[model samples]
Target: MLRFAPSPTGDMHIGNLRVAIFNYIVAKQKNERFLLRIEDTDIERNIEGKDKEIMEILKKFNIKWDELLYQSQNINFHQNFAYKLLQEKKAFACFCTPQELEIEREKAKKEKRAYRYSGKCEEITIEEASKRAEPFVIRIKKPKSSIKFEDILKGKMSFDPNEVDSFVILRADGRPTYNFACAIDDMLHDITYVIRGEDHLSNTPKQIHIRKALGYTKDIIYCHLPIILNIHGKKMSKREKASSVKWLLEEGFLPEAIANYLILLGNKTPKEIFTLNEAIEWFDLKNLSNSSPKFDIDKLRYINREHLKLLQEEKLAKLLGYEDSQIGELAKIYLEEASTLNELKNKIDKIFNEKRDYKDFEKEANILKENILEVIKNSENFDEFKKELMKKSSLKGKQFFKPLRIMLTNQEHGPELSKIFPILKNKIEEVAKWW
Candidate 1:
């Protein structure tokens, strides 16, 4: 089984969604069960409805999971496992006070050394600790040897025994820490694969230690995807509005387009554009780039336009709040200048709704409007229509075309009239009436 575990802290970033896409697609390709685990154990930081919102976003992207779970549901199990480790002598109670630990940390800083637990509390017998009134935390024993594992994308990796101290499993507040809960849940849920961001690479050995301490000898495959950089050549930050998936969706980006762009990043694909289903046929983990990939908004906009073009003319028009296929075809002409559905809709709306100001050319605009209304009915095309109207007005150059362009498109400049005129030939009367 595979899992896409997200914390309910705030709006999910595109980085989070990209990780989910990788896990979901790989699970389907392997014919394995997929799970959505909402890691909401950090109650202090979790937003109340964000988990439901996350599921909704996943559904919008067509990600289906075989099972769903919240990490808090197994709090009892996580607590019990900590006690189990203590009983097996795989862990010990930590009696260090906050001030004492801080002093040790300062000492390490002064000595220019890494701050690890002094393990002073290990000398206290468990029986002796059972009778103490002071509150204490549970900590797993440090490994005596290196913890090593192979990552599908990163290849062989190793962590020294000293790198992982006797980290706390259960806090003084009777709550399990992140690594303890994550390790316990993965073991209990039978998660065979872990595909996540490289930010969690340091936590892997700690989790592996917890599993090994519990006698879970089965190997869990791992793929730590490289970090994504913004266009400015820095790591993507979730706090930024542009990094958010919610903001991207609200800006009228297609879900398919977003997924296509994400999958195309840092990986080799059969083609530049494809649907989610098409990607499932060819996605392989081995093709992922080890180097970080930059998030190019321009490229995503280009991909969004391609996906918009793939939509049927009638359907595309419906998304733009119109029913006529002609309107849909008309919208396509604006696609040359518009990158998003909202931009396309605004461009189309300009034709029939936006009030154009003629400024210095008001007189010429009115004359052109009257002439076009009179001769447009008989003209078969824009060139034919222009020939008849220009003859009647006896106007030429900027004096003729400028006002005519504003009368037809409600804009001083836009797509060539030759391309827009064909789709909007029937709507010319309505367009002229509004202007």
Candidate 2:
């Protein structure tokens, strides 16, 4: 099974969604279960409605999960396991004050040595430790040997035992630390694959130690995706507004477009665009780029436009919140002329602009107006008028409709002449009087 565990600290950002999408694809490709786990261990930073909003967005993008787990609800389970490790002599408690640890760290740095816990309280008997403990954080005792693991993507990664930090498994307040909680949760949930961002790669060695101590030797596959960076080549963050998914949503990006663009970040692809299913078929961890991918708004917009163009009129209308009846007409106009939604909106603005007058017509209108007016004035019927107009003007359909479009709708370009004419047929006489 695959799982996407996101902390509900803030809105779901684009970088986070990239990881979710990658995990979702892997699950679908392998016909395995995809689960959603809420890593809300950090209660202070939790945002209300964030989990619901994340679920809603994932649903909108068609990403599904088999189970929903909350770390906060399993506090007892984690505590029990932490205590078990302590009993087995694989973990220990330290009552070191913040100042003392900082001083030790600084001394090590000054001496160009790795800063680590000096085992200050490692030898203290349980009774003596109980007496001295004002408030203590539990730390895992690192084994004095090298640890090795095979990363699914990076491969054969190893870390020396001494280099690994003696991390806190339980806080002074009794809450489980992130590393401890993640290891316990992964084991409890039977997660076979650990797919997450590369930022968590450093924490892997520590988790491996915990897994070993707990006797979980069935090596889990770990695939760390590359980080997403801003266009300036810096790691993306909320401070960099450009990286936020909420910002893109606010700027009118369709969910499909965002999902498609995100898949391009690290995955190898020769094609410029792909549908959700196509992306799943093409997704492979081996093809992921090692370097951080830059988020480009322009490229995202281009990809969105292509997807928008391919959408069925009804779906497009539903996504854009236009009425069903308005869909066909609007889509026809959009497909025929506009390269983008903005362009279509601009044309709509021209249609509704009350200030536009006959004098605002293009120069070509002034050149052809006299002949057009004379032909209209002399014609005996609508059919005769059409025939005469077609004969006098060498313009084909587009040129023929150009003047009529400006006359009836006061717009330079829009829906096809046939479609636009039928919709504006009643206004033809009123516009003919202009010439």
Candidate 3:
């Protein structure tokens, strides 16, 4: 089994979704279970509807999970394991206060030294430690020897024994820390593969140590995916525009488009557009880019247009949620000539509702009226009308529609005349009233 655990802290960002996609692809291709785990151990930062939104987005992308688990619900299990480690002397409680730890950290920073707990309470007898009755955090006892592990993607990595921090397994409040909680959840869930961001690379060794201490060390794979960078070459964040999935969805990007573009970010193969099945078949951890991939809005738009073009006419209409009968009719005609569905929708949106006035078209409309009215009267068919008007005047669709469109809909561009003409042919005579 594989799992994608996300913290419910804010809106789901594209970077986070990319990680989920990788895990989904791996599990789906292997015919293994993919679980969704809410890493809400940081209760202070949890958002109310963020988890629901995340699940909804996953549904939108067709990312299925076998189980949905919350880390907070497993608190007791994590605490039990921590206590067992404590009894085995593999973990010990430290009564160091926040102020003392901060001072020690600052001193280490000033001295340009790596800070490891100085074992202030390492020798404190358990009885005396219990008698203190002071709030204390349980810390894992680090082995004197170095820790080494093989990252499936990055190969072998080694961390010095002294450099590793004696991290807290359980906080002073008796809540399991993120590292401990995640490890316990993975073990209990029988997750055979752990796929997450590269930022968690350093934490892998510590989790390995914990598994060893718990005597549950078996075959497990860890694949740390690369990070996604913003256009300016910085890590993408919600603070930046177009970084969040919600923002992108609002900007007219279809869910399939977003998922397709995200998959290409870190892993691009010969195939340009990929369906969910194709993604599952082609996705591999070894193929993920080592360097962070840049997120370009322009490229995203291009990819979206491609996906939009492939959608069925009815699907596109359903996706856009267009209800107007005329708009749907216009969409069919516009799509025939449009390079993509987005372009088709763009053209239809122009005249779907009341016309929007523009300054340039307002001035140009007056000069083009006499010629446009005569052309509209003379042409027998829509196709012939366009050709005749194009010959007499160099102006194409926009220029031709500018005066007539403004006269009727008060907009410069709109649904193709070929489409609008059939629906609004009666309105043409009414438009003639303005002339």
Candidate 4:
């Protein structure tokens, strides 16, 4: 099984959406059970209704799951297992108060050394602690040596036990800590692979230690996805103007394009435009680089323009809020330079009809005699009309159509004249006289 575990702490950022896409695609490709698990244990930090907002964001990306669950609902499940470890002597209760721990940390900082837990309560037996009836937290008893684990992506990584102390399994407040809770969930759920951002790389050895301490041997592998960076090469943040998925969709970015761009971010692919199925066929997650990948917004726009080409005229018309097929027709023509649907709207508005405001076409229009308007007003089809204008105006080539095109649409070069009149419905007289 694979799971997309996101903390409902804030708006689902673009990086989170990318993580979900990676996880969802892997699960889909393997035909495995995929699920969403909200790590809401840190409930105090959660924004109001963020859980609901997260769900909506996932749906917007077509990230469907087999089961939906919360870590909060399974609090006792994590709690009970933590106690089991405590009973097995794999973990022990700590009686050190916050002030005492802080003092030790301050002294360590003064000594210019790393702060590992003092293991103050290691000698204190559980029976003695229960007899005292004092409040305390559980800490896993990690050895004072190095811990090693193999990563599918980074390969053969090691961490010092001193680098990671015997971390708290249960907080003094009786809430199971993240590493402890996540380990229990993953083991119980039979998650064979843990595919998540490398931001969680530090947490891996800790979780691995917890599972090993539990005496259950399961070969659970991990694929640490690279961290997504912003344009400034910093971690993506809302303060950095890293857009949310909702905002991208609102800006008229195709969801397919967004998905494709996210997948391409530190992974290899020969082509830009691809369906999710194509993505699965092309992407090999184990071979992905461990380097941090910058979230290139410009690259996303380029890919969106590619997907825009795939859009059917009828569908493209509806997306632009146009009932006329001419808008879609002209949109495809303008979309060669369009990155998003809003840009398409601007381009479509340009040629859906002529520009009455900008009369830069006046100079171009002056070159064509008033007699050309008479021919244009009387002509039926575009071909016959162009012939009449050339014959009467005594002009041919760009000298003829170029000025006529400028007068009609106010653009130097644009949609074909044949397609234009059908779109504009023949206001050549108004166009010529107004200029």
Candidate 5:
């Protein structure tokens, strides 16, 4: 089993989406069950409706999961596990106050040493703690030896016992901490594989410790993908506009194009461009690079443009609010200047919605504009049409071509009229009468 566990805290980050894509693709490649686990246990930080927003985004990306679960719903199981650890003396309750812990932390800072938990409550007996009125938190007993595991991507990893102090399993308010709940849920779901961001690397050992303490012997395959950096070479942050998947979609990026770009990042692919379905055939976690990959908007735009070209002409026309397949072909002419669906649509919209006043060459331009339909109908091609239109207006050189150009395309400069007039011939009446 594989899972993409996201916290319901904010907008879905692009990095997280990439992780989801990797997990989903790997699950398909392995023929394993995939699941989405919303770690909504941090009720204080979770935003309302964010979980639904996450589901909507997943749907947009076509990432179907076999199971959907919220971490909060397993509160009973988490509590039960915590009690089990306490009963076995593997964990104990601590009555330390926040202020008291801070003072010890400050003393450690002054002494230039790491602040390890003092384990002051390790001697507190269960019956003695049950009789006490003070609020306390359950903390797992610190491991005596190093915690080690082999990450599928990062490879052999180890953390010393001193690095992992006795950490809280259940908070004073009875809510499970992130690592505790994550470990328990993975064990409960029998998750055999975990593909996630490199930010979770440090938390892996802690989760492993939790599982070991619970006597859960099964091991989960871990692949920690490299961090995605911005163009400035800094870690991508949610504060950046391009970091949000919703922002990218609103900006007119095709979902498939985004998936293609992400899969190509930090990994070797069979080809430069491919669909999500194509990726599943060859994607392997072992092939991924450990080096961080930079998020390039220009690269994404290039990929989106290619994906656009791969669309059916009729479907491309529909995206631009047209039914004619020729209109779709006409839209492709502007691909040199437009990279996104919105930009392409704007280019097509200008053809049918622009108002041409013919102010500079009012008489000459108007004469050609008025006779455009008749001249175009009579002539089979642009050269023939231009020749006949000039003859009708008795105009030549700049006077002849400038007004004709404005009258036809409503712009003084653009793609040569020769290339445009052919595809646009059938739509001439609409273009001329648009004003």
Candidate 6:
């Protein structure tokens, strides 16, 4: 099984969607079970509605997990495994207080050396340590030799055992740290593949140690995905504008387009537009690049336009802020060149908003302005009126239609003059001939 674990701390950044996309696609390609587990161990940081909101977002993205779990539900289970390590002599309770550890850390800084935890409590007997009423946290005993594991994307990784100290497995408050909880849960869930962002590689050795200490012999694969970076070449921040999944959905981006952009973020697949199923068919760990993918908003807009072109007229009409069934005809004309629904809104806003300038075909626009009232005053057929107006003005080609376009829409280019006429309705007379 493969699992996606998200913390219910705040709004999910757009970057989070890629992790789910990779996991879901991997699960489908491998024909294995996919699961979702919410890591809500830090209750202090948990926000109300975040879990529900995340569920809705996943649903919106069409990511369906075979099994769903809450890490908070397994608190006792994790604590028991920690205690088991203590019983097996694979772990020990550290009685060092915060102040004592802080002093050692400061001393390490002053000595210009790395801070490895002093094994002050490593030799303490379990019975002796258990008898103490003072608060304590469990720490796994790091083996003295080098550790090695094979990453699916990055192969044959070796870690110096000295790089990691005897890190805490459980806090003094009896809650599992992220590494400890993740390891135990993976083992419990029988997860065969662990795919996630590359930043978590530093924590892998610690998790592997916990697994070995707990005697979990099952094989588990690891795949670290490349990250999405900001302009500074660091991980994209959640605070960045328009970075939240919720915000993008609210801004009228189709979920399919977001998925398309995300899959292509680091993979460099030739095809930029694809559905979720297509993405699954193309998902390959080997194709992923080690370099961080730059988040290109313009590329996202291009993807959005591709999706907009495929939308049904009724759906496009709704997205265009028009409920009129006739707007479907309008959608068909403008959406051909529009990149976003907002851009469509701007193009059509002139029908309802105040008019600006009409600079094109000045002489032809002048003729149309002078006689358009006379044409409207006497004729019921637009074809008859436009034919007569053009003949009377002795203009042809763009010189002829250009005036009609500028006089009606105030823009040099748009849908054919015939289509925009319906949008102008009775407001055409409001336009002055003086300009």
Q: What 10-residue stretch in candidate 2 is worst by lDDT?
A: 421-430
**Cα misplacement distance, residue 164 of candidate 3 (Å):** 2.5
Name the candidate, 3 or 6, with the larger lDDT value.
Answer: 6
RMSD of each: 1.5, 5.2, 4.2, 4.1, 1.8, 4.4
- Residue 385 lDDT, candidate 4, scale 0-100: 83
Best-to-worst ranking by lDDT: 1, 5, 6, 4, 3, 2
Candidate number that wins on TM-score, 4 or 6: 6
lDDT of each: 0.91, 0.76, 0.77, 0.79, 0.89, 0.81
Per-structure clash totals for the candidates: 0, 0, 0, 0, 0, 0
The segments of candidate 2 whose C-alpha lies over 4 angstroms from its true place after superposition are 112-114, 325-435
lDDT of each residue in 1-435, candidate 6, tens digit only: 999999999988877778888889999999999989999999899999999999999998999999999998999999999999999898999999999999999999999999989999999889999799999999999877766889988999888877757999999999999999999999899999988888899888888878877778776889887778876677788887657888878776788899898888888675878889987877788898888888877788789888877777777778778765455556556765667777776766554455546565676677666677676556555677678777777777878776676666656777766754554444455544323
C-alpha TM-scores of all predictions: 0.96, 0.81, 0.86, 0.84, 0.95, 0.85
Error of 6 at 100 (Å): 1.6
Task: Report the C-alpha displacement of residue 1, candidate 2, in angstroms.
Answer: 1.3
The TM-score obtained by model 2 is: 0.81
Off by over 4 Å in 4: 144-146, 349-421, 426-435
Q: On residues 264-339, what C-alpha lDDT tens digit does candidate 3 reach at each position?
A: 8777565777777777777777877788899998787777767766667567676556754544555555544453
Clashing pairs in model 4, backbone N/Cα/C closer than 3 A: none
Candidate 4 lDDT over residue span 27-92, tens digit each: 888889987999999968977788898888778677898988898888898888888888878789
The candidate that wins on lDDT is: 1
Instruction: Report the Cα lDDT for residue 134, model 3.
Output: 74
Cα-based lDDT at residue 42, candidate 3: 94
Which ten contiguous residues of candidate 6 have the minimum total lDDT? 426-435
